[model samples]
Target: MRMHRIGAAMAAFATFAVFTLATAGAALADTAVKFALDWKFEGPSAPYFVAIDKGYYKAEGLDVTVDTGPGSVAGIGRVAAGTYPLGFFDINSLVKFRDQNPDKAVKAVLMVYDRPPFAIVTVARTGIAKPKDLEGRILGAPAPDGAYAQWKAFVKENGIDAAKVTIENVGFPVREPMLANGDVDAITGFSFSSYFNLQLRGVKPEDIKVMLMADYGLVLYGNAIMVNPEFAAANPEVVARFVRATIKGMQDTVKDPDSAIDSVMKRNETADRATELARLKMAIRDNIATPWVMANGFGAVDPARLAASIDQIAVTYEFTNRPKPEDVFTAEYLPAAADRMLK
Candidate 1:
């Protein structure tokens, strides 16, 4: 009986050893990636969560952790500083950042927002019909707002007198509120975000006017996935995997924004399902799945258009060293065109 019991115990111990080795090997195989986002876990951000929940990253052997950032520009700095290996941020801001910090080797790998979401949002009560109308009006803008950062370019391109406009540097939380309460005439924000946020604050849709910067004269790309140069160089395959997983997430989000919003809602308890769904749909319509991206594939930019945008940025920004389109963006890490096509 004693001999039989010893034999059974040895077999059980051998099985446990195999299980432990397999578990350790699996953990070792998975690469941890710290991802930073330009903004909060909102509708536009649901795709990353979808990727996580769907095991897209895991399938790529990447363990990605997506964290919210303060602003688009801030996300750029986060990636550039190497605090995060990869991040999502405004491509225009990245352009400026690269120019400002020439030594830092940060570049956009995927063009997510083909059409920029920069806009001037106002209500009918404000009577701000056109860019020119912005003059002599009180415009509420957060200092760190990506839209507000383009105010100089917008004003110059639209022939609006910047000095005539009373720019109120408002907080992000109070940006829509001040406009809803008639404290400010208009606000600088993303069309999808500020527009829906105003409606949530009891503002009528018909009363709201969204002057998209793309409709105006700011020929700029909105946001993209950026990478730390050293990290990307050391782990090229990992970057490619990250991009592939992200593309999958974006495709899934486009197919069923309703289901995608569920991923975001789980992360952000304060997010209202209806508002975020509307935001996601609006982002898809106006920014993500634009005519250009639909005709071509997603995750890549038009070289000529990007060159034109760089020239436009020069109108307001005096770059010490103007970077070529290749310097600011790269298509190497992105998957094939077939893999990135959105519905």
Candidate 2:
């Protein structure tokens, strides 16, 4: 009887141990991650969709939920609020957020685009050959801040009187129509994607003039991966894995853009597949193939470039003080996948 009792006790202990281990394993596998997007899922977001379709996140032992939000500010805000772990945001906006809320503890992990995609698109026949010619012309802008301010600053910096230009606030999607119908003489657009869309719509290339923001020293980083510093600090391994998977996704998108487009279309059926595919290809070629993205590495962040961007943002936005460049991003979390591909 004594022997039987002892055996039963041992069996119970073994069962408890097994249960505890299983529960811990399950918890580790169920690490929930939420990624907030600066805008709706489209061509620029192909890599993320590719990652999800390929089970890259699952392979990394992470369960990720991708949520598209209003814009960069809202996306970053949600991440800072601890409601989400990661987000896609503009580097300029991230710097602004860091300056305004130093205690938030958010940092950029990777940059999807090396250069700014913002541009001023005008019909060539309008005779607005340069930024200077924008004087006395109606310019449609996405918002009163950021892109608009930058455009005005660019015009002013180039010796054009911003006061002479009539500014109209138009949303992004409506900007093209406004320009086409002559409601606005010129409009802010993404050079790679928006310009491509116009060309697709039978607008002759020579008839459209695109003054890319990057050409005017408005070289802010766009579509960067950001994470809450607290989460990164607490779960370094998880962060590393996430970055690894993301870089792989980016590489896959670059190598086979068509497949990437298919992946994006599968996930976001509302997007215009042809236009989005064209945009994705253009983004990969124009933005991703730059010296910064190609030489240094994919998703790499340059402190000097970042500092310059912060300065530009401060000047454009008329901020009383600008935050330090180091406050916006950390190179510590960039994955090896990007580094490997660059080599």
Candidate 3:
């Protein structure tokens, strides 16, 4: 009886050891990828976290770590420097960055914001109602702000006299406060960001005006997922898997923003649940699910539209050598349209 018991115990131990080794081997097979985001842990960033928490990335044999960035423009540099294999940033900034570097292999892969969130936020008391109202008014704009980068283009498009407007170089933290305290008559930022932030600061909803740049003839795409060309070339499957997982996250976000905010709150402890939820929903309704994206599909851009946007960008930015749309973006890694369409 003792000998039989000993033999059974050894067999059980061997089976357990084999199972543990196989599990560890499978875990080791997963490719580790670090993802960079344009801004802090906020409503719009929830989808990526959702993908991580729900095991969407793991299912694709990827281990992705998402980190917050300083601003939309910073992610461009991060990806180009090979600090992160993938990042979300302003495509317009990426265009200009490529125009200057001409050597960096950073290219936008997924178009997240079909319509740019760039906007000029103001209050009714400021008497700034239209683009022309900005003239002679104090405008608080962060030097590195993605929206402010488009000011030149916006001014040219709307025929606003740029020289007449006094732009104050405010930090991102101070941009909204300056406007709320009446320190500056207007501020340039993302529509959803500035709008909600101002409301949180006691600024009434009816009083604020968000003049979205896209609404004012600035034909531009917003933030997109970018990748280092070398990394992408070496791991095309990994890139494809990353895109697929991200799109799955986006779909979940669009369908139930309320549930999505849970993911953001998990990362951002100080964030107001209601405020972040509102911001996430606004981003989805305004930027992510635009008519074009709804009709065509997500994660891709129209060639003609992208071409027009490039031409519009040239109005403010002088490029030494312009590049074709294909030079900056690719649909090579994107999943099929049927798979990407957000229902």
Could you tell me the lDDT of residue 128 within candidate 2? 88
Clash totals for all candidate models: 0, 0, 0
User: Candidate 2: worst 10 consecutive residues by lDDT?
Assistant: 144-153
Arranged by TM-score, best first = 3, 1, 2
Whole-model lDDT per candidate: 0.91, 0.77, 0.91
Q: Tens-digit lDDT track for model 1 on 239-267?
A: 99999999999889988998999999999
Q: What TM-score, over all chains together, does every model reach?
A: 0.91, 0.89, 0.91
Best model per TM-score: 3
Model 3 lDDT tens row, 1-343? 9999999999999999999999999867989999999888999998899898889999999989999987888778878888899999999888888888889868899999999999999998988889998999999999888899888889988889999999899998889999999999999999999999899789999999999999999889999999998899899999999999999999888888889899889988998899899899989988998988888788999888899999988887899868789878899999999998877
- Which of the two candidates, 1 or 3, achieves a greater TM-score against the reference? 3
**Per-residue lDDT of model 2, residues 156-232, tens digit only:** 55788888989888886777777877788988766765686667667787788888777775657776888887888
Q: What is the Cα-based lDDT of residue 105 in candidate 3? A: 68
